[model samples]
Structure formats: structure tokens, C-alpha cells
Target: MSKNPLTTILEANIFNGTNYNDWLRNLKIVLDFENQTYVLDMYLPRALPEESTHEERLTFEKWHKDNRKVCSIVLASMTNDIQKQYDRHDDVRPIMPRMSQIYAVPDQHIRYAATKVFFDTKMIERSSVQEHGVKMLYLVEKLGDLKADLAKEMYIDVILQSLHPSFDSFIVNYNMNGFDKDLHELINILVQCKATIEKSAQSVLVREASTSKAKGKGARCWRRNKGKTESTTASAQSAPVAPLGMGKGKRKAVRQSLIPKDVCINCHEKGHWKRECPKLLPNQAVKLISANGLQVVNRSRRLRQTVLKFSNGRVVATLV
Candidate 1:
């Protein structure tokens, strides 16, 4: 068959195939955008093995090596582009908002960490002039239960003693009493109460504070008596101390632990005689006070807390 010279030449070129694998190996040298500025992504396939295999199988190890080379090139190019953009800046870029210098401290004078405090003052009438052969002395007498309004003052005195290790002789409020009770023992009990309340209250405060602050609100509950809210306590101060049989036991005292004198054999709780126990009575539902002081009706659930406080600084607490 007669053929044109150009067609014959093209057929001859197709027949003579080039070795692509060899071409890749020769281009193995790394190329930088500007001398050592940055590198552009490039890949080069490795030469084939000398031996032949009946089953052609691709392996992840080989694929990964090629992928790594390609990634490094891309990364280098990105780095170069960013550096160029930064160099072209004509005006000074504003600094990022100074990283917040977070701290656990608050910047306020009246703020307190943990510890209940109170201030107290009282007026007493006394003879100012000394009669003949009489030695009249001026004394500042301690009287009255520290009132709520003066709590801040009392807090200062306590805080001072706590801050000054040398003032160890200063007695905390709970240890001071007119009665002959052992002051040391009373102080220990008070310490335990303070510690417990401090820990729990701080946790609650921290959480609430964080949430409130996040929502652009004040961190404080703003309630002076945040934890105290009961009617009985409010009435206790004015309510004439009921006779010995009437005053409920105060659990703050460490000497005695409170427990039900009589357990229903059916259910256990104080303020109830076994016979009067609702659990023992057939078909009679039992209504009991919960930890929150809410009345819940149940036969199996036991009462959680024994102490009850009133708003008036009176507490009805039980020792466990």
C-alpha cells in the first residue's frame, strides 16, 4: 500500500515508545521557588524491581512514600505564599487583643473568699465618776448576738486574726461563748463546719460565677444570706427559748450525735414514735421531708438531712 511520508513517520514514532519511569528518576532534584525561599510540590516514581511478579499487587507502603513527597511540596509552597503576603504590608497591623491575663483573684475591697463574718457593738450604762475611795473604770462590754448589719465589722476582726499567724490567741466566733463549755472542743466543731461549708459553697459559687460572667451578668448572688432561708430560724431569736423539752437539739455541738430514739422497725426517722410511724400503719401513705425541706411521700426513701434552720439565726441541726 502506498502511504504519505508524514503518515509513515508518525506510525514509526508511535512504535518507538519512551520510558516514562526513566524520565521521572532524572527529575528527582528538588526545586525551590527563589533559591532557598520555598519548595514547590513534585513527585518522582521509583524505578521498577529487577525481578518479575506473576501477580501485580499495589502496596500501601509504596503509595504512602509518594504521597508524603507530594504533601511536603504543597506545604512549602503555602509557607512561601504567606511569607510574601506578610512582607508586602505597608501599614503596621494591629496587635491581636492582648491575650487575657486570667487570674483567680477578684479586684474589689468588700469581696471575700470563704468564711462567714459579723460585726457587733452594744451600749452599756456605767458610773463615770468615782465616789470617795471608789475606783470607777471605763470598760467596753461585749453584749448582744452580732447582728446582720454589723457582719462586715466582725468579718474584719476574724480575717485579721486569720491573716496574722501571731494572733492565734484570737478565738473564732463559734468558740467564744458565755457558757462554761470547753472552748477548744467548740472551736474544733466550728472549724469543721466552716471547712465543709467553705468547700461546697466555693464550688457552687465558682460554677455560677463562670456561667454568669460568660452570659455578661454579675458573678455574685447578691443575697447576703444566700444559703439561709427558713421560717423557724427567723422566729427563734424572738421566740422565748422554749423550756428545755421544747428547744430542738442544736447539731453544731460536737459532744452528742443525734439519732432517732425509736426506729419504726419499719422505717427510721426522728420526730416520730414507732407506733405512730406511717410506714407501720397498713395502707397509710408516709409523707417525709426531703433534703430541700420539701415533703415527699414514700415508704422506702429515708430522710437525708436532719438540721433545719430558720431565718432568724436559729438552727435546728442534728449530729449524725
Candidate 2:
């Protein structure tokens, strides 16, 4: 218990009312790792019945102890607002099933969150550009799954915008040429470009090292050229880096998703999905794309990223 596996997962991802699905899976993983999953599967009676054998009583005692441990872990994992509501008096099922109901937000909120995350996503420093690009693609896919309308150009631009400044030249060239390419092709081009930039940097380093080796004439010549270098450096530093995606006043735009026709399962009427059916039962809850639903969305700060770093030292970041 001293080394809880849930700590790391919880540190990165808290329940926070919005990410229950992820928290639930992570908690389950903790239980499974500790060989305590039976606490959830085997429901025990509050008290032993008369004539119950010693074996039955022993099983009940162990189950009760394990259930309390799991319940404590569950409550500790949740945020204060949520933790205060659940009373730990019985098996874990009673508590979790109700939470599943309470944590679900409206589709309108989900749609808004998804859209915001797509726009605000920025590539992490030292991470793979291809990975960053792929994550952007996944965000677009999530928007699509939510039935949010988006233009192809917006999708492409959003990914391009997420990249770091190392890709400014590439972005400018791409915008100028107006090449029509999908997300996969775009990622490939970025991978190649990153390699090229790194190579150029390596060659610069090699030339500098070789020049330093010639201490006599080379050192004298280098010192003589210092003034010219100083002037060039000052001029280069003074000229600001231009923002990308500018050609004939090219600017970024995000269009609202076009609504598709829907047929309600409950009412058998057009213009609506099951989630918002007008004739549903009082206790029925319709699911969206999957059982987990809309997935927990991150509302990251909106970013105006200008740098596409050429750092590939880290592994590729996957879309979780």
C-alpha cells in the first residue's frame, strides 16, 4: 500500500467530474494489480445468516475487509465535491453505478469542450512532430464522432498551427503552394523536414569544430571576420520572425459543424437523436458513440504556437 500505482495516474488525470471514465479504468487497474478485484465481483451480505458454516464466515470477513479498502481508495481518488456525496456503507457497485449517472454532462457541453480542445492543442516540446500531428488528427476525429461539422481546410490548418516554430518555413511553403494533402501525408512531410533541419544543425556544428582546430591562420582569420559576423548577427536578431499561414492575408478560421439529419429511436421522428428524444422513459439514458461516451475532454488554454521544434529526442506521444 506504500507504493500506490493509482497515484501517478491520478496525478496526471483526476476525476474532476469530467474524466470519470478514465478514472474508473485507472482505479480498476489498481484493484486488479493488488489482486483485490474480487471485492467488486463478490458481493457480501451485511451480516451472517444463522447456521452459516465457519467457511462462509471466513469468506465474509475477508470480503468485508477488502471491500472497505477498495471503497476507501475509490473515495480518495475522487475530487472533494464528488467525494463528499457518496456514503461508504455497502458494496462498491451501489456507489459506482450512481456515479456513472451523475458524472455525465449534456451533449451540448461535450460538443463545446471537444471543439475547444482541438483549437487549443499545442505540440509538446521535444516530442515527435509526427506524434503531435497524429494527436491533432485524433482530435479532429473526436469532433467528427460528436457529429460536429468541420471543413477539411480547418482540420488541416489546426494541425499545422499546433506545430512548433521549427516548421515555420514548411508552413509558409505549404500555405503558398496550397497543396491538398491528408493528415497522414502531412505527418510524413513533417518527419522528413525535421530530419533535414537536424542534419543542417549537425553540419553547422561540425564546421565550427573543424574551424576551431586551425589555431594559427584560421584563428586570425576568424577574429578578423568577427566584426562582419557581429553586424550580421545584429541584423538577423533585429529582424523579427514572421508569423506563418500568411499569403494574400491568409488567416485561420473554424467553421461550425453542419448538423446531419437524425431519427429518434424513442419517438421514431426525424430531426433528433436518441439522446434527446422527446418520448423517452423517465429512467432511460441513451448513449452516444460508445458506452464510455464523449470521452473526457481537456479544456487546455488556447495557444498561438509559432515554433515547430526539431527535437526528436523523446518518444512519440500517443493520443490517449
Candidate 3:
């Protein structure tokens, strides 16, 4: 026996209370493939009476058989729950329409829902502008299917309004130019705008990352320099001083080594030599030298004093 064509083909989607439209659409494809779609269209001839002519009788009988086969195919595709509701109807025409009415949403309700979805949809941060625009278009198509009166401008507005703030500039320019664009044109513009925005955002992120890295490096360098300065200061304060009789060369070398490289030995300030230091007056310079504990070896002088040693080997006397 030949395999049943219905069994050979992939089974149509079984109606499950809902999804009547999708199920019906798939069922039509199957029926069309099997050359049994005539039953749904009510084109199949009815059975003839006994008094009919021989040719007429044969034609009616063949159509009757085809009609019954188509009806069985439709019934087989339905789930048990949906099948029970329309199984009493032997003709596919009445059965299909009745099932559609029972399961499909009313036209008005679909339109209302589509309108609400179209207007209420807003772009979220997680979704790109292209994704948001696509969703808007899908809702517009749904409305169009219901014969809803939606103008091109209205749809463009809907899509534009649903966009995230990232497209603010585009929106402003679009409104300023009063550009009249159809759905396709608007979608293309939105796609390009989204690409530019994403690219700009990526560039900004890269710059910020590089800037942050540079700042971090600078902070680390500053911290390292500060630490070296503090350590040098602490070591200078803690270092044991050599006896007074130590040669000027050895004493000067030890003092210079203990002091921070940036600090001046004469004025104890940074960034200038003692000779050119404006802050160090002649008296202040003498006091600074006396504070260093350098005593002058003068047996003839009754008063004890300290001497300031310059880098050029010049010595100046100051009373302690």
C-alpha cells in the first residue's frame, strides 16, 4: 500500500486552543501541497442524487471522495482539544472559519493592542537603536494588517520617539530639516545613526581608558617621588653627625650626601644656589651656617664663633 501523503509530509502545527492563525496558515500550505485546498475554499462538488446521469454521478463521487480526504487531513492536523470543538462539521470550509473565530483575536482588539504597543514602546539602554526601530516596524506591520490608518509620518514619529537619548542629535536635525521619510528610508537613517553613535561611544571609552591609565602612571610616579623625598628627610634627621675635627671635605661630603639632592646646603631651600637665593639675607645666611655646628679654630679670639664654608672654599665668620 502507498504511504499516506499526510504521513510522508511533515505534520502541520497542531492547534492548541491558541495560535489558530499560525496553525491555519501552516495547514493551508499542507493542503495546497496535497491538492486538497479546494475543500477549504468550498470548491469541491457535493454528492449527486441517485437520478443523476452516469458522467455526473462519477464526477460527483470523485469530488465527494476528495472532499472527505481533505476534511480528514484538516481534522488530523488539529489537536484533540480543538478537534472536539469542530469535529461535527464534515466540510473544511465551515470547520476552518468556525475554528478561526473561536481562537483568533477580534480585529478591533488586535488593532487596539498593536496601536498601544507601537506608541508605548520605548528604547531601553540594553537594546540598540536598530533593535528598537525594528520592533516599532513590526508593530506598524501588525497594525497595517488590521487595516489601521497609519501614515508614513506617524510611523516615522513613532520610531523616532521610541529611540534612546543617544539619538537626540539625529532627532533634532531630522525635525529641523522637516525631512519627509518613508518607513524604509527612516530605518536606514536610524541604522546609520546608531552605527555612528556606537562608534563614537567606543572611541570615547578608549580615550577615557587611556587617559585614566596616564593619570594612574602619573600618580604612581608622584607617589614614588614623594616617598623618596620623605625617606631622605627621615634619614637626614636620623643620621649621626661626624665630630667637628673631621676635614671640611669629609664633613661637607657626608652632609651633602644626607641632604636631598634638590635641597640647597646654604639656604636649605630647593631650586637655587645660595649665592643667588633672594630669601637668604646676609645675616640669615650667617645664621643658617652657624646652625650647622661648624666652629672656627681661632685661639686669639675670646668669643667662640662658627664659619660658613662656601663651595668655592670661601670662609665667612659669624658669632654663635
Q: Which stretches of candidate 2 lie over 4 Å from their true place?
A: 1-18, 21-97, 124-126, 215-217, 220-320
Each model's Cα RMSD: 42.2, 50.4, 14.5
The Cα local distance difference test for each model comes to 0.34, 0.76, 0.76
Per-residue accuracy of model 1 over 79-198 as CA lDDT, tens digit each: 343324333322111100110122112223112211122121211222111120011001101112211233334433432333323223333442364323332343344345445655
Question: In model 3, which regions exceed 4 Å deviation?
Answer: 1-13, 29-38, 48-70, 87-90, 240-320
lDDT of 3 at 58: 75
Whichever of 2 and 3 has more TM-score, that candidate is 3
* Full candidate order by TM-score, most accurate first: 3, 2, 1
* Cand. 1 Cα-lDDT: 0.34
How many angstroms is residue 169 displaced in model 2 relative to the true structure, after the best TM-score fit? 2.3
Please identify model 1 stretches exceeding 4 Å from their true place: 1-179, 213-320
Clashes of 1: 10
